[model samples]
Target chain A: MIAPVRVGQAVRLAEWAPGAPIELSEIPANSAKEFILPASETIGRYDRDGARFTMRETTPEGPRTVLLGVRPCEAAGLAIVDAVFNWDSRDEFYDARRAATTVVATACAQADADCFCTSVGGAPGATRGADVMLRLADGGRQFIVESLSARGEELLRSAHGVTEGEAAADPLADVPVRFSHERVTGWLAGQFDSPRWQEFSLACLGCAACAYLCPTCHCFDIQDESTRTAGVRYRNWDACGLGLFTQHTSGHNPRADQMARWRQRVMHKFSYYPEKFGMLACTGCGRCARMCPAGMAISDTCRAIDAEESSPG
Target chain B: MSIAEARDEAPGVRTFRLTFTDEPARARFFGQYRVGMFGLYGLPGEGESTFCVASPPTRTEYIECTFRRAGRVTTALQDRGVGESITFRGPYGNSFPVDAWRGRNVLFVAGGIALPPVRSVIWNILDRRPEFGDVTIVYGARAVADLVYKHELADWQQRGDVRLVTTVDPGGETADWKGQVGFVPAVLEQAAPSAGNCVAVVCGPPVMIKFTLPVLSKLGFAAGDIYTTLENRMKCGLGKCGRCNVGSAYVCKDGPVFTLEQLHRLPSGDM
Candidate 1:
C-alpha cells in the first residue's frame, strides 16, 4: 500500500512496508504540493561557449506514480492551486509534474477543530482533485474504492479488489460549516479599510508558516542563480505575509505592515481570485489555521468577518 | 533578437533598440502593440524583467527599452553586447487611450528613469500632432545626468507645437544647466498648464506622484483626467505570478495604466 510514513517530525508519502501498516487515520501535516509543484527546480540553464550563448529548457524527470491516502480537503486544494498555475500562461514545470501524478483521496474519518471544509464548498468525500477515492468498509477491515475520473477508471479496471455490485454507503467525516462563504466574500469586499484587520493581525509574527504549509497559496518569485561559467533561472515559493512581498526596489512598500499583508492573504483568496478566476483560492484544507503559531484560524477569521455590520460607503 | 543600437541615457541607465532575428517575430511585434504597453525582456538564464516597450507605437520597425541597472536581470542586460540574444515576451497589459484624447490638450509629466513609460505616449501623441491640441511637457530629474531621453527632450524643445519645461533638483544643476531648478511638483506648479479640456499623464517614483497628484488637483485637474502607471514588481506579466497587486487589481493585468479615480478606489495606504 502507498501511504504516508512518519519521517522524523513530519509525515511523508512513501511505500508502506509489509510489517508497517499504512497510516490513514490522521491527516498528514504536509500536503502533496511538492509532488506537483516542487519546492525548487531549475527551469532552464544557460551556457556561454566563448562569445556564443546557448540556453536549454530543463526536462522534468520523474516516473508516473499514484498518490494514495490524500485527504479530501487536501485533494480539493490542489485544484485551487491548479487554477493559478494554469491561468493564462501555463507553467510548464507544474504541468509536466501534474501530468505524471495521479491522486487517490481518502474520505476523512476523523477531524479536529481546524477542519472546516464544508464552509468553503468542500466536504470529507469531495472528489475535486482526486482521480480515485477510497472509503472504509462497514467492518473497517477493507476500503470501498470508487473511480472519480477517467484515469481512475483505468486504474480501477486492472485492480484485484473484490465486488462491484451495489454502491457503498455514505463514507464521509462530520465537519461543521463554520461560516458562509458568500457572506465572507461580501464582508471582505468592504473591509479594505476596516480597523479589524489591524486588530486581527496584531499577533501575527510574519513567520509565513501559514503560507508555506498551505496547499493553495501559490505566490512565487523567479530569480537567476549563476556559477562562474553557467547559470539557471528558477522559481521558488514567496509568501505575502512578509512585509517585503510588495516592496519596490526604490524602498517604497505597497503592503507595508503586517495587517496589510494579512489583508492581502484573505482578500486574494476570497475576493480577488474569485473575481478573476470564478473560484475561491481556498479549499478549506485548514493547514494554515493548524500550523499558525499565533492561534490565527481562517475559520474564526471568516466567522468574525461575517459577524461585522457593514457601514455606509 | 539582438541589440541593434544601445545608448547611455543617464547614470546607471541605458536604452537598447532590439531587432528580432526572424522576420516573423519582428512582424508580429510591430503588428499589434500600442502606446503605454510593456514587454518582458531578459536572457533565458537571467529570467524576464518587465518594463515599457519604450519606443512609440508609431515606430513599429524595432522596439526599444530603457532600464536602470539596479537588479540582477538589469545588470545582466547591461553586460550584453550588440550581437547577443535575449528573450522577449509581451506587448502585454492595456494601452493608454490616446485615440480618445484627440482634440484635447495633452500634458505629459515625468521624473527620473520613469520617463520610458510616458515617452511611449508622448511620442504617440507627437506622431499624430495635428489630431490633438496644445501639448505641454514638464519633466524633472535628480540631476542633469539623471535625465533620460535627452535627444528626444532636445527635439521636443525645438518643436513649434510642444512646450517643454525641463528641470533638475535644486542642487543637481551644472554650470551649463539651462532649465528650471526645483523639484518636479514645484516646477510643475510654476509652469502650470491649464487643466481645462486636457488629460494629464504622469509617471514617476512614488514620492513624486504622491506630491504631484495633489498639485494637479489644486490646479483643477479632475481625478478622472489624471493618469499614471504603477511600475510594481512583476514576474509573469500575465497576471498569474500574483506579485504585482495593490488591491483586488493585478497591475500586470488590470493596469500598469490607471486613472486617479481608479487609483482612489484601490485600497489606501497600500501604494
Candidate 2:
C-alpha cells in the first residue's frame, strides 16, 4: 500500500485499488497547495566575502508529485491562487512546482451543512484544476476516469493496470446553493462599513486557523535570516487575519480592530479577488467553518449578505 | 561604490546617496526610473525596504533614498557603508502626474520622512520653472532637528517664484526657530492659499493625512485635485507579495498615488 496522506475531516488517499472505494464525503484538511506553494520556501541566498557580496537564486528542484483524491472544490482552489502567482511578476518557484505536479480529483458523493460549492458557481463534480476527474463506476466497485488535460492523458497512457470502460453516471452530491456568489460580491462591495461585519465577527478569537486551512488563501510574507556572513531570503505564508498584517513602522495600524481585519478577510475573498482576477477566492469547501475555533461560519456570512439587496453593479 | 554620501535627516531617518559600481546596472536603473517612483532598496543578505527615489529624476547621475531606521530591512540598510553593494528592484509604482499640472499652480505638502516622495516632484518642477506657474511647498516635521532638506528649503525660499513654508509641531519648535509653530494642518490652514486653478500633492503619516484632508477641502480644493501616496508594509514591489492591499486596491499596483476622490470610493477606510 502507498503511504496515505489524510486531510480535511480525516479524508484519506491511499494507493489505487481497483475494487477499493474512494473517500468522497469528507473534504481533505490539507490541500494540494502544499504541492505547489509550500508552507515555506527559500527564494534566494546571499553571502558576503570580506567586502564583497555574492547572491545566488534558489531554483526549484524536487521530485514530480502526483496527488490523488483531490475533491473538485479543493482542486478549483488551486486555480484561484494561480492567477495571483502568475499575474504581474511571475513567481518561478510556483511555476516550477505547478509544472511538476499532476492532479487527479474525485467527484463528491455527499456534502455536509458547511458545503456550498454550488453557491460559488462550483459543482460537486467540477473539473476546473484537475488533470483527470474520477467518478464512481459500477456501484463504487470501479472508477470511471476521464482525462481533462494533456498531463492527465499522459498519466493514463502510462498506467499499467487500467482498462477502458464506459463512462459512468457521476454520483455528485446534492450541494444546495445557499447564496449567489455574485450577489454576495455585489453586497460586499457596498457593505464596507456595515455593522454586519462586527456582528458576524464578534465571536472571532483572532485565531487564523480559517486562513491557514483554507485551500485558496495565498497571502505571503518575505524575510531574510542570516549568520555572520551568509543569509537566505524566505517567503512564508501570511494571513490577513493577523493584527500585524498592515501595521506601519510609525506605530499606526490601518486595520485597527478585529472588525476591520475581519472585514478585509471577507472583502478580499468575496469582493477584491473577484474584481482583480475575475474569480472568487473561495472554493466553498467549508473547511473554514468546520475548523473555526470561534464557530464563525462563512456560509452564514454569505447568506446574511445574500438576504440584503445588493448594490447595483 | 556604495554610500557616496549619507546625512541624518532626522532623529531616526538618514539620507543615503548611492552609486552602482556596475555600469550596465546603473544604466538600466536610470532608464527605468521616473519622478515620484520608489525602489525596493536592500542589502543582499538583509532583504529589501521600500522607499521613494529621493533624488530628482532630472538628475540621473546617481539615486538617493531617505529612510527611517525601522524594521529589519531598514535597520540593515542603516548599517551599510560607502562601498557596500545594495540590491535595488525598482522605480516601481506610478509617477507623479507632473506634466498634467503644467502651467498650473502646484502645491506640495509633506511631513517628516514623507518628504522624500514629494521631494522628487519638488525638484522635478523646480528644474523646469517656466513649465509651471506658482510653486508653493508647505513642509513640517516633529521638531526643528527633524526637518529635512534644510538647504533645499532655504534655496526655494530665496527663489523668485517659489513660496516655501516650514513648520515644527507643538512643543517641537526651538526658541530660535522662526518657522510656523504648530501641526502641519493648523499651519496650512493659517497659510491657506487659493485652491483655484491648482493641484495639491500631500504625503505624510496617516494622522497627518486624516487631519489635513479636511483642511484641503475647507481650502476649496476638489477631491480630485488632491493627490497623495500611501506606504504600506510591502515586500514585493509587484502585487504578488500581497500585503500592501487596502480593500480591493493593491497599493503596489493600483496605487502608491491616489486622488482623494479615488480613495473615497474604496470599500473601507482601513487605508
Candidate 3:
C-alpha cells in the first residue's frame, strides 16, 4: 500500500491537514542513504551546516526536502539537537534546515539491544518531540496518524496518496514501564565522591563514538577549516568522553580523569539540566550503551550511583 | 520583559548591556532591572560566558559589562559587529550588594577593563546620591591607552563631592600623563583614605588585588571594610553549567565580589 510521493504535485492529504491527522507510510528509499538522515551525516559533520551532512550529501537545491514515512525517534532526535544549536550561539545553519523540513514520525515496532529509552526516560512508541506521528496497527492494514506539531498539521494537509482516517489508541501503554526515575536520580546525587566511577569508567576508550551516536548529546568544538586560498571557521560536534575535549591551551585539563568526565555526563543529563531548564537532557535512546565498544550500559549505571560496592574513601 | 544590547566602549572590551531576555527574569528582580544588565556572552562556535549586571540596578533596563580579549570567547566577540545577532544567557552571579552599600562611603577601585562590572556600583551611587557617602575612585591601566570609561571619566571629574585619581604603571607614557604613575596598591597607600569611615571596593587584574590588600590593611582598613570583585571564564551563566566554578563555590553563585574578610578565609586556590 506504500509508495514514493511528492507532496503538492500528486494527490492530496488522507485528511484535513492541520485539524486532521496524516500518516506517512513506508515509501521506499531512492538508494541506501538518499534522505531522512541525521544532519550530522547529511549536512554538517560536527553539526548542521548548509550542504554539509555527515555523508557530504547536499540538501536538494530547489524544492523543500520531504522525509516521508519517518519515525518518531528520529524526529525526537532532531528536537534534542535544537537546544544545543541555539545555546551559546544560534546556529542558523541548523535552524534554517529544520525550518525547511517537516518531521512525520511513526511508532517504532521493534526495540534493539542498544535501546534504553525506558531507562533514560523515553518510551518505545514516544510522541514527545515529533511534529506528526503515526502508529502502525497489529493487522498492518491501517495507520493512526497523529498530528503533534504545527508543521505536522501542515504536512498532513498537503500529504497525498492515502486514505484519511484515525486509529484507536493502543489499549496498553506504549512505554516500557520498568525504570523508576526518582530512584535513579536520588542514587546519582549522593554518589559524587564514590570510587565506582573509577571502576566503571576504566574501560572507556575515550573514542567519542558514544557522543557521536547519541540522540541527545550535543557538545561541539569550533575550528577554522581552510585550504590555502579560503578558510571558513566552523564548529563541529565534540564529546566530553574524550580526554582532550576540555583541555585548555595552558595544558590544564579540568575533566582530565575518565571518572570525572563520566560524572559530568550523568550530571548534565539528570542533575544539571533539570536544575536549569526543568527538564532532563537524556532521551534514553540507549545508543551510547549499544554503540560503546567498551560495553558502557546506562542501565547498569542506574543502581550503581549509590556506589553499592565501593566504600567511601 | 528585558532585552540584551551590545554597547561598545573600547578595543577588545565590550560593554554588553543586558537585562532580562525573558519575562520571568523581570518578574523576580524588576524595577531595578535593566533590559541590558542581563546578558550571556558566548562565541559563535564555542560556549557562553557568565557576567555580572554592570549597569547600576537603578537603571532598570541595561546591565553593562566590559570584558578583555584574553580567551577564545572574547576574541570572537572582537570580530563581531554591533547589532549583529549574539546569544546571551543571563545576568548571572551575585551582584555587588549595592542595596546594602547604600549608607556607606563607597570607594570603587578599578584597574583596566576590571572597571566594567564595578562600574555598575559607581553609576548607582551617582544615580541615587542620597543612599551613600562621598565617592572616591582609584583606577589604573597598564598604559593610558588601556583605560575604559574615558568619556565617562570627564563627567565623573566634574562632580564636586566625587574624588577621582587615574594612574598608569611607571612604564606608561608619562609625558602627557598628569595623573599618578605607579601600581594600584602603591597608589592606594599614598592616597590613603580615612580607612575607619570608608568602604573600599577594588576590582582589577589578579596581581593587582594580591598586592593591594595588605596596603589597605596597613592604612587601618579592616578586612571587612574592603571588597573586591572576581572573574573567571564561565559558561551557561546558570550555576548548572559547571565551567565557571572554583571549588564548591560556583562564582556564579557565591560571588564575583567578596569582602576582604571573606577573601582572607577563602582558599586562594578557588580564584
Candidate 4:
C-alpha cells in the first residue's frame, strides 16, 4: 500500500509495510498529483543522425497502484485534472495513469486550521473522487470500510479481513466553512482591475511553492533535454505565479505584474475554471496557505473578496 | 519534417520552407490545414516554438514558417542547415473564415513580425481570387531593414490584382525608400480602404493593435468584420498545459483567431 509516512520532518507518500507507522494527523505535504502527473516526464524522444532525425513517442505504461490513505481533497485533485487532460484531444499519458490507479480515501477524523474541505463543496467524509472510503471506528482501532465503486469492491476482495460486520464510524472532523465559493466567484467576475490583488500579493516572492504543493494546480511546461545526438521532450510542473509563465519571446507579458499573476491564480480557480469545467479548480485544501513562505492564503483572499462583495460600496 | 529551403527575412529573423518526409502525412496535413493555423517547430534538443504556418495551405507542396531568432528553439532552428530535420506539430487552433468572407474585399493590416499570419490569409484569398473581391494589403514595419518577405512584398506590389501599401515607421526610411513613413495605425487610417463589404484582418504588437483597432472601428469596420490573432505564450499547443488561456477561452483550442467582437468579450486586461 502507498500511504503517508514521516520522512525526516515531512510526511510523504511512500510504500508501506504491514504494521508500519503511518502519519494520519496531517495530510501529506505532497499531494497525490505526483502519482498521476509526475513532476517531470518524458513525452517524446528523438535521435539525430547529422541532418536527419527520427522521432518516437514515449507511451506511458501505467502500472496498477492504489493510493491507500489519501484525503478526500487529494483524491478529488486527480478528478479535477482529469477534466483538463481529457478535454478535446485526450492526453494519453495522463489518461493511462489515471485509469490504472484506484483511490482509497480515509475520512478525516481531525481537522487543522489549514484544512477547509467544507467550503468548496467537499467534506471530511465526502466520496466525490474516492473509489473506497475508510472511516475510523472504535477509537482508531478499526476502520469502517465502504466500497464506493467497482474498483473499491475489487480492492476489498483482495484484502485479508474475513469478518462481515457493521460498525459506527467515529465523528468526522469539524471544519468550518470559511467563505462562499459562489460569492467569491461572483465577486471576482467584476473585480479584474481591483487594487486588492496587489494588496494580497505584496508579500509574494514569486515562488511557486503554492502551485507545487497544490493538489489541483495542473499548469505545466514542456522543454527538451538532450546530449547532441539524442533528446527527450519533457513536461514539468509550472505555475502562474512565476514571472516567465506567460512571457512571450518578444518580451511582452500579458500578465505583466505579480498583482495580475496573483489575480490569475485566484480567478482561474474560482471563476474561469468553474465557468469552463463546471466545477471549481480549488478543493479548499489549505496546502497553499500552509506551505506559503510569505504567509499568503487563498482562503483569506476569498474571504476578503466575499467581505468586499457583501459590503456597501 | 525536413527544411527544404531557408531564407533570411531580416536580421535575427528567418523563414524555413519545410516538407514532410512521409507523403501520407503531407496529404493528411494539407487536408486539415487552414489559414491562421499555427505549428510547433522544434529541434531535438531545443524544444518547440509556436508560430503561424506562414505559407497558405493552397500551396500544398511545402509549408513555410517565419520566426525571429529569439529563445533557444528558434535560435537552433535558424542555425540548422537546409536539409536538417525539425519536429512539427501542427495545423492547430481555429482558422480564419475566408469562406465566409467570399465576394467581400479583404483588407490586411499587419505590422513588423506579425505579417506572417496575415500573409497566409492573403495568399489563401489570392489563390482563390475569383471567389473574393478587391484585395488590399497595408503592411508596415519598424524599419525598411526589418520588413519580412521582401521578395513577396515586391511581388504583391507588381501584381495588378492586389493593392499594396508598404510603410516604415517615421525616421526609419532609407534614402531610396518609396514607401510611406509613419506608425501602422496612422498609415492604415491614411490608406483609408473602404470598410464596406470588406473583412479586415489585423495582426501586430500589442501597442500597434491597441491603436489600430480604434482606427479600424472608425473606418466603418464593424467589430465582427475585423479579425486578429492572439499571440499568447503556450506549451503543448493542445490546450492542456493551461498557460494560453485568456479568461475561459483556450487560445490553442478555441482560437488563435478571433473577431474584434469576440476579443471584446474577453477580459481585455489579460490580453
Candidate 5:
C-alpha cells in the first residue's frame, strides 16, 4: 500500500510495509502531487549532429497503483488539477498518471488547527475525487470500506481481505468553517488594488513553500538540460510567488513585489480560477499554512477579507 | 524547421525565414496559420521562446519570425546560421479578424519592437489589397536604430496604395533622417486618419499604448474599433502553466489580440 508514512520529522507518501507506521491523524507534509506532476520530468529529447538535429518524443508509461488512506481534501485536490490539465490542450503526461491511479480516501476522524476543509466546500468525508471511501469504525480498530467507483469495486475484488460485515463508523472530524469562500471571492474581485493586500502579506518571505506543498498548485516551467550534442527538454514545478515566475526577458515584472505575488496566490485560487474553471483551485489541504516559516495562512487572509466585506466604509 | 534566410533588423533584433523540412507538417502549419498567432522557437540546448509569426499566411512558402536577443533562447536562435534546424511549436492562440475588416479601411499603429506583430496584419491586408479599402501605417521607434522591419517600412513607403508615416522620438533622429521627429502618440494625432469605416490595430510598449489609446479615442475611434495585443510572460502557452493570466483572462489563449472594449472589462492593475 502507498500511504502517508513518517520520514524523519515530516510525513510523506511512501511504500508501506505490513507493520509500518502510518499517520492517520495529520495530513502529509508533501501531497499526492509528487505522484502525478513530479518535481522534474523529461518531455522530449533531441540529438544534434553538427547542423542537423533529430527530435524524439517521450511517452509517459503510468503503472497501475492504489493510493491508500489519503485524506479527502488530498483526494479532492486531484479533481481540481484534473480540470486544468484537461481543459483544452490535454496534458498526456498528467492524464496517463491520473488515469492509472485509483484514489482511496480515508475520512478524517480528527482535525488540527491548520485544517479548514469546511470553509472551502469540502468536508472530512467528502467523496469528490475518491474511488473508494474508508471511514474509521470500532474505535480505530477497523474501517468501513465502501466502493465509490467501478475501479474501487475492482480493487476490492482483487484484495486479500475476505470479510462481509457491517459496522457503525466513528464520528467525523469537527472542522469549523473559518470564512465564507463566497464572500472572500466576491471581495477579491473588487480588491485588486486594495491596501489590505500589503497588510495581509507583510510577513510573507517569498519562499514559495505554500505553492510547493500545495495539492492544487500546478504551475510549471519548461527548460532544456543538455550538453552540446544531445539534450532533453524537462518540465519542472514552478511557483508564482517566485520573483522570476513572471519576469520578462527585458527585466520587467508584472507581479513585482511580495504583496502583489501574495495577492496573485490568493486571487488565482479563489477569484481567478473560479471565474475561469468553475471551481476553486484550493481543496483546503492547509499544508501551506502548516509549513510556512513565517506563520502566514491563507485561511487567515480569507477571514480578513470576509471581515472587510462585512465592514461598512 | 530549417532557417532559409536570416536578417539583422535592429541592433539586437533578428529575423529568421524558416522552411519546414517535413512536407506534411508544413501543410498542417499553413492550414491552421493566421496573422497575430504566435509560435515557440527553440534549440536543443536552449529552451523555447514565444513570439508572433512575423510573416503573413499569404506568403505560404516559408514563415518568418523576428526576435530580439534578450534571453538565452533568443540569443541561441540568433547564433544559429542558415540551414540550421530549430524546433517550432505553434501557430497557437487567437488571431486578428482580418476577414471581418473586408471592405473597410485599416490603420496600423506600431512602436519599437512591437512592429513584428502588427507587420503580420499589415502584410495580410496588403496581400489581399483589392478586398480592403484604404490602408495607412503609422510606425515609430525610440531611435532609428531600434526600428524593426526597416526593409518592409521602405517598401510600404514606396507603395502608392499605402500611406506610411514613420517617426523617431525627438533627439533620436540622425542627421540624414527623413521621417517625422516626434513621439508616436503625437505623430498619430497629427496623421489623423478618418475614423469612419476604419478599424485600428495598435501594438506598442505600455507607455506608448497608454497615450495612443486616448489619441485614437479623441480622433472619433470607438473602443471596439481599436484592437491591441497583450504581451504577458508565458511558458507552456497551452494555458496550464498558469503564469500568462491577467485577472481571469489567459493571455495565451483568450488574447495576444483584444479590442479596447474587451480590455476595459479586465482589471487594469493586473495588466
Candidate 6:
C-alpha cells in the first residue's frame, strides 16, 4: 500500500489515468469539456446548451480518490452528510459519492467572523469529517496530513507527492478547537423541550440555504419525472427549512410553522439521529452559521438549550 | 431497513418481518436479534399506523404481524404476497406491558379493525390466564359482517374465563346480530365498568379513541391509568424518519400504545 513520489512531476491520482495535477476546479471543468470520465464520477449534472457537464470518476466504481486541497470546513461538511445519507433508508447515490471521494483536508488557519465551528463542535482545523486531514503544519510548508479514517490511510498510501511518515499521535490535543462535543450532544439531547426553537426559527429565512451550504445537511426528496413513454425516479436533496418540504399531496403540512421546521433541524441532528443511529448527526462544522445572513449560530442555540436543561428548576 | 422476511397473512393482508441484514457479513439478523435501538422483531416499512404484535415478540417462530389493506404501508403490504420483499426498520413502537398487568383485570375494547393490536393484548392476557383477573372484551364494528377474527371472538365468548361482548352499528348486515348495537363508547357507558384496579385498552380510528377516552374517564379512569394505541405515518419505524413525530416524541419509538398522560404531554399535535 506504500509508494514513493516520482521525480519531476506532481503526484498523479489513479483517477487521471496518467500523471498530472488536476486542481479541484479543473475537475468540474474537465468533466464539462470531456465525457471520458466515469458516470458515477459525475457528482452532479449541469444542463447548458442542451448538453450536460458532469464531474466524475475514471471508472463506474473505484477505490477512494484524492480530492486534494479541499477547505477544512468543506471537509467537515462531508461528515454532516453521513447522518442523513446512511440513515434508515440509505441513499445509494449519496453513498456512492461518499465512497468514491477521499478528502485530504487542509485546515483553515484564519477563521472569519461567521466561522463558529468551535462554537458548535468543530474548529478551524476540525477533522470530524476528514478521512485524511492536511493541516498547515511546520508554518504551512509540509502539510501535517493525518489519517482520520482507514480510507484516509489508504489514500495517503497512494498519495504520489508526499513522503509517508508516522502521524503526530496527538494532533488535536494542543489545537485550540474551542468546542466540546460532549456538551453539544448533551445539550442537543435534552433540547426537545426548549423554547429557543421558536425564536431561532423566526430568524430563519426558510430559503434552505443552511441545508444546501452545510457539508452535513442531507435532506432529499424522490421524484418520478417522466415523458409520455418513459419515467425515471430520481431523488434530490431536500431541506426541512423549506416551506413546502413536508407538504402532503392533499395540502396538509406537518411543519407548517418555522418553529416546527427549526425543531426538526435540531432534532434530526441531535435527537432523532442519535436515537436511531446512536450518534449525533452534526459534526458541528458550522457551515450554516458562516453562510447564513440571518446571523444565527446553530452552536449558540444548541448550547442555550443545553444550559436551560442543566439549570436548576 | 430492507425486507429480511415476508409472508401473506389472512385474506388480502401481508406480514413482512425484518431482523437485521449486515451487508458485508452477508447474513441476516432475525427473530431475537436486537440490532441497535430496535428489538429486531418488527416490520418497519409499514408506516406507523401502529399495530401490536398479534403473536408474541419473544415467540419468534415467525416474527408475526398481520396488517389490513388500510393506508399507505398497509396498501403496499396488501399488494405483497408470501416471499415478496419490502424495506423496513423495526418493531420500534411501545408495546403493552403485559407482565405488569398480571393478576389485574384487563378490559379490551376493539372497535372494528382495531382488534388487530388489541388481539395481541388479548392473546397475551389469555395465554397466561392464571395471571390476570376476569377478562372482559367489548368489540364493535360498523356492521356484523365486517368484524375481524369473528370465529375467534365467538370461541372466546364461549370460554369460561373470558367474557366477550360483540356489537355492531344500528344497521345490522349479518343475520347473527343478537348482541348490542350503537357505538363502542355508548356500549361501554351502558356497561358501566368500575374504575378500580383495571386496565382498559382501546384502539380504532382517531375519532373512536377521542370519544372512548371520555367514557373511560367517566368510569373514573385516570389519564395515567387509561391506555390506547396511536397511528401515524411511520416510514422508518426506527424513529429516524421525521413522519411519526408527535412533538419531540417519535410515536414509533415512544409508542403505538401509550397511557393517556403520555399522549397529553406530546408537544406536536400530530397525535
Best by lDDT: 5
The candidate 2 chain A region of ten consecutive residues with least summed lDDT is A1-10
Tens digit of lDDT per residue, candidate 2, span A144-251? 888999999999999876886575675679998899888888888777878788897888777878887888988888878887688888888888888887788778
Predictions' DockQ, in order: 0.57, 0.69, 0.06, 0.80, 0.79, 0.06
Better of 4 and 5 by lDDT: 5
- What lDDT score goes with residue A90 in model 2? 86
Clash count list over all predictions: 0, 5, 32, 0, 0, 17
Docking class of 3: incorrect
Query: Tens digit of lDDT per residue, candidate 6, span A63-118?
Result: 44555555555565566556544644565555665677777665655544444555
The CA lDDT at B147 in model 4 is: 99
- Between prediction 1 and prediction 4, which has the larger TM-score? 4
Model 4, which residues run further than 4 Å from truth? none
lDDT of 5 at A77: 94
**Candidate 1 structure, TM-score to reference:** 0.91
Model 1 global lDDT (CA atoms, 0 to 1): 0.84
Ranking by lDDT: 5, 4, 1, 2, 3, 6
- Candidate number that wins on DockQ, 2 or 6: 2
TM-score (0 to 1) of chain B for each candidate: 0.98, 0.96, 0.86, 0.99, 0.98, 0.79
Query: Which parts of model 6 are misplaced by more than 4 Å?
Result: A1-62, A71-102, A110-114, A137-142, A147-213, A218-258, A270-313, B1-30, B33-95, B140-158, B165-197, B210-228, B238-242, B245-270
Pick by DockQ: which candidate is best? Answer: 4
Q: How do the residues B67-158 of candidate 4 rate in per-residue lDDT, one tens digit apiece?
A: 89988888888889788888899889999999999989999999999999999999899999999999999999999999999999999999
- lDDT at residue B103 of model 6 (Cα atoms): 73
Categorize the docking of model 1.
medium
- The CAPRI class of candidate 6 is incorrect
The C-alpha TM-scores of every prediction are: 0.91, 0.93, 0.55, 0.98, 0.98, 0.61
Question: Candidate 1's residue-wise lDDT over A1-313, tens digit each?
Answer: 4567776666766665766655766677777787776667677788855445677667866558777888888888788888877866787778887877788888888777888888999898788899999887765667888898988988888888657665545456789988888988988777788889988788789988888888788787887777656888777878899877787766778888898888888898888889877888887878888888988987787888876733344
For candidate 5, what is the DockQ-based docking class?
medium
Q: Which docking category, incorrect, acceptable, medium or high, applies to candidate 4? A: high
Answer with 2 or 3, whichever has the higher DockQ: 2
Q: List the residue pairs that clash in candidate 4.
A: none
Per-candidate local distance difference test: 0.84, 0.83, 0.60, 0.90, 0.91, 0.58
